[model samples]
Target: MSYDLLFTGGRVLDPGSGRDAVLDVAVSGGRIAAVAAGLPREAAREVVDVAGRLVTPGLVDLHTHVHPGATYWGIEPDPVAWCSGVTTWVDAGSAGAYALPALRRAIGGYQVRVPVLLNISAVGLTGRTGESRDLAHCDTDLAVATVAAHRDLVVGIKARIDAETVGPHGLEPLRRALAVARACELPLMVHIGAAPPTVGELLPLLRAGDVVTHCASGIALGRGGLDPALRRAYDAGVLFDLGHGSGGFAFDVLEAQLAAGMPPHTVSTDLHGRSLHGPVFDLPTTMAKLLAAGLTLAQVVAAATVAPARALALAAGTGTLAEGVPADLAVFAVEPGPFPVADVHGRRRTAPLRLRNEATYLAGRLLPPRLPAPPPPWIPLTAAQRTALAARDRRIRDLLTTPLVTPDDLADQFPRPPDR
Candidate 1:
């Protein structure tokens, strides 16, 4: 059978399949047809030459907030996905039982796949914080029923356990979230921040396959070192995710984890409205932070792809380029770098390599590039960032305002009558 599209001469680095070689990837019927060393160019309808580019499964960002215009943290993933090569954008707890339907409706409008980690709080981040301050919002029965109703969309459960979010409730909110996760038999992804219920109390409650996002949080980790309890959780198979939101990741804390031989199981941008512009720009930038932290390129790729897919037990072939999988693919230019990358605090690190997206495709259809909307009024920005944004707006205005061509460049259609 003839293939629909072929990507020739790319370094097909599919960590899920353990295949990393200069090869060709063919797609047909919106599914991967083959991944072989060579294929007849004549058999495919269109062949894209991707020489010297790195090709892999479209990235799966395990933690993000994509229910825009509804949740305060939400940002539209499409504008970011096309340019970043992230096809699976997991909306981590932007909606809870009360708000799940709205989140579900929001995702339908997107081109890329968006699986949700249903928020434990019924309010679901509609505001900036306090999603779980009231235990009533953390109703296990409601959350379980919501999961049962939308198993197709809900991948896991999410709870942000922190001082501001939980208030005086402490670990009660988390206990309720765990109850929902247990009832559904789905993994739980908990976001950790400041105290009332510290990581010490929080880590022991989580079971295997459950994710602890913001694993390197300085505020949560206290003294900025690997606590024994955190180590125990890691040993007991609790997965760590670098949920690099506005205040989540800290360089020193991550460095300590690395020193202790504990690496994050997955790297994610937690790319909400607050973190979208600065600190956490996209998944690739977040991945580069791990590169700066000393994880090998292959290791980072696995954490971003197969590990997260397995962490959530996502659909079959979700992170693999195996034949019959939906042809979700990405192509990137491996830019060598002494590139400067920063963490939430003003700390900096130089990365050795950076992957920049050239193209992203989902179900064998190329994602169109889309410009991002201006930052919302409440999103905090540095003065320089504000100035840069204004300058960019001016540039776009200037380009569009200018005439397309001079009068002399145009040809007359009715030259015989000297058309006006």
Candidate 2:
């Protein structure tokens, strides 16, 4: 049977299906038709020769903010996704009950698959922080109902259990989030940061399958050996996620956790407005950071793909290149170098390899290149960053204005009608 597209000459490394070799993946009708050593190129309508790149299932980032107009954290996902190789972008609580409809409207415009974690607070991230300060905003009943109605889009529940987010209301917000998650039969993803309700206080409350994002936060969990509280929670089957945001990831904290034999279950970039410009640029960079911290390429790939998909119990074959799965895939050149990677605390480490996305595909279609929008006004940037952005804009303008081909270089298809 003829195939829609054939991707050849790439090292296929889909950790989910234990596929790691040079394989040709064929796509037909937006699903994976075959993955084998040799797929006859003549049988395919289109062929993409990814000679020296790594081919894997599209990276599934479990934490992001894509609701552009509805929240301070939101960023447009398509532009970033096209270049970053992230196909399944899970917006980590950019919307609560009130703003979910707006988030849904925005999702309709994105080219990537967008799953969301509904915020426990009714007023979800409208402001920078303090969303759950007013205990009344943590409306469990409304949140549960919202999840039930939008189960197709929402995969889990999110709660920011921090001193700034919850104010005088200690762990009440998390408890309410748990209530909603329990009611909706969804996984609960809790963001950890500087705490009034300490890690020790909240770790016990989490059930198996609950996720602790920013698990390496220096501000919340500290920089020493793994705390017994964390150990207990981990042993009890609580998933630890590397939610590497602007203030969440610390190199030392991650290293210590790795030393303690507790590797992250899922690696995600909490890619929101503030963290988008620096620190947490995309999922690939975050994966590189994990590499610097101690995980292998396969380990991080599994964390970014299969592990996160499994954590949220995503669709049957959401993160694999197996036959019959959707043809959402990423191609990357794994450049080897002593790349200096840094954490939120300005600590640094040398990454042995970095992934540069060469092409991204979704549903057997190549994702077009999309330029990122300028940072929002409220997003603070250094003077150097501002100048760099200005230069980039000028470069794009220059490229667009310049002529592609001169009269002699162009083909005269109509033959000018004999100078009529």
Candidate 3:
């Protein structure tokens, strides 16, 4: 049988099957037909020679906010997905029951695959602090109903257990969220930040499949390096996700965690409007950070592809490039140079190399990055849309007005850890 397309002379890496070799992969009718070292280029309608690049299963980002024109922090998924080698991205609590209709309407006709983690609060990340400030919004019944109604879209639940988001109520909202996750029999992606309940307190509640996002934030809430509770949770099968947002990732924290034998199970860029320009650029960047820290390139690729797929409980073939699977793949160029990497806290590190997405293929269709053009207007500008956009713009303006943080500002804003 003739193939539709063929990728030739590239190092093929499939973390799921531990298959790493220089091979030619063939695709037919949107599924991978064969993977071998030599397949006649004449057999395919198109043959792309990718000699110096690496070919792997399309990257799957387990955390992101892509409810474009809907959520305050949302960015369009396709552009980010295509430009960064991410074929699948999970919307990490950009919408809840009350706002999910708009998210569903906005994401229609997109080329990429986006699974969603329904927010526990009725009104998701609408405001700056996020959705759980008002205890009344943590309605398990409403979340359960929404999950049941949109079972195909809703894969899990998200609850931000941050000091400002949860406030005085502390772990009550989390309890409600846990109840909702249990009721739906879906996993929970809990965003842990500055604590009123603390990371230690939160770990006891998470079971095997539940995910702890932003585990590398260097906030002063959880006491000591690598909290014992977190270690115990890791041992108990709780998954750790690198939710590298504007304030989530810290190299110091990541190093400590890695030394503790708890490297992130899934690498995800908590990609949102505020972080798109800076430290948390994309999923590929996050994976590169891990590679620089210690993980082999293969291990980092596994975290981005198979590990995330398993965390989300996707079907068997979802994150593999084995024959008969969907032909979703990413081609990347590993450039050697002094690539500077930064964490959220202005801490810097230099990675000897960086991974750049050369091209992405979703079901055998190649997608390239859009050339620089004027920013497009957000579509379907309803009242809700305008409110969120205006708020975001105001924050952006404030960020611009605040002169670039000088040495004094950095010293004042991010205090050094007290002398032990």
Clashes of each: 0, 0, 0
* lDDT per residue as tens, model 2, 107-217: 998999998899999889888999999988898888988888898989999999999999998998998899888888899999998878999999999999999999999
Quote the lDDT for 105 in model 2.
89
- Per residue, candidate 3 scores C-alpha lDDT tens digits across 1-420 of 799999999999898977899999999999999999999999999999998899999999899988755566787778677778898878999999999888877767677888899999989987667478788899888899999999988889999998889888889989999999999999999998886788889889999999999888887323244888889999999999989988888888899889888898989999887677566868888887887788888899999899999998876577789899889999999898577788888788877678898999999998765421112353233465457657767887798798897777665667889999
Model 2 misplacement above 4 A: none
Q: Which scores greater on lDDT, model 2 or model 3?
A: 2
- Model 1 over residues 63-179: C-alpha lDDT tens digits? 999987887988999999999999999999999888888888888999989999999999999999998888888889999999999999999999999999999999998999999
For model 3 the local lDDT of residue 188 reads 94
Residue 143 of candidate 1: its Cα lDDT?
92
> Candidates' TM-scores?
0.96, 0.98, 0.87
Clashing pairs in 2: none
lDDT of 3 at 92: 91
